[model samples]
Target: MKTYYIKNALRVLLGLFMTVAGIGHLTFQREEFLAQVPRWLPTDPAFMDFVVLSSGIVEITLGLLMIILVKHQAKVGLALAVFYILIFPGNISQYVNEIDAFGLDTDRKRLIRLFFQPVLILWALWSTGGWKYFLSKVKK
Candidate 1:
């Protein structure tokens, strides 16, 4: 029971974090996030803006679902983990291109930041039992 509560708390915290990040994507930190967009992508500013905005919307939705859809948390967690995976390239781009944003000013810092992506993915899965859910499905 204690473990369950702890997981719930962590899930809620992750949701809040993602919500704020999504807001940052849409608002205050928009420019900072723009730096993370892979340079290989089209340079058209409008298209880039669309990518950021759409991803922000997806983040917001996933965050809210992670919080409110407790009964479906496993699915929500899976979705959020997938989302984290999807955005991993952005983090990679930030590191590879040596683009500074969110205080990852140095190459080492950006490189270290890359490792946290897997942690976030694990956190999402573990907090909502998505890891077990997925494993069970795979075993069947």
Candidate 2:
């Protein structure tokens, strides 16, 4: 069916996006990206390393899960949405602390990234059937 193909297409697109992002985070220890986290953030070097590795692994896993497995796809999508929400505070901290340690030079660019945060969240929710699931639960 057309609908089925569309759904798969959307999932694949999202998966590819995440996969590439994770890979970048893993491979590019770019100073620009590292500068975003301030020195006073109480982030231990080991912990930060673990975070980087785990985040990449999680992203890769989720992409594979969404693309390779046919069943429980919606649940996997929901989990990915939750993961996006969980990482939101990091984005907030960057904005609130004015940590331009990242290459973002202007407040405008930081604010723009903040806007993008929710868009990604909403996209994940919609892509994963969270909205439909919520509606079904509400109807019941």
Tens digits of per-residue lDDT, candidate 1, 54-120, equal: 8989989999999999999999999999999988998999988899999999999999999999999
Candidate 1 lowest-lDDT run of ten:
34-43
TM-score of 2: 0.78
Whole-model alpha-carbon lDDT for candidate 2: 0.69
Q: Residue pairs in steric clash, candidate 1?
A: none
**What CA RMSD would you report for each candidate?**
0.8, 2.9
The C-alpha stretches of model 1 lying farther than 4 A from their native spots are: none
Name the best candidate (by TM-score): 1
Clashes of each: 0, 1
Best by lDDT: 1
For candidate 2, write residues 5-106 as lDDT tens digits: 777788878888888767766787433444444444568876666666677778878877767765766677777888877666666667776767455567
Candidate 1 overall Cα lDDT vs. reference? 0.93
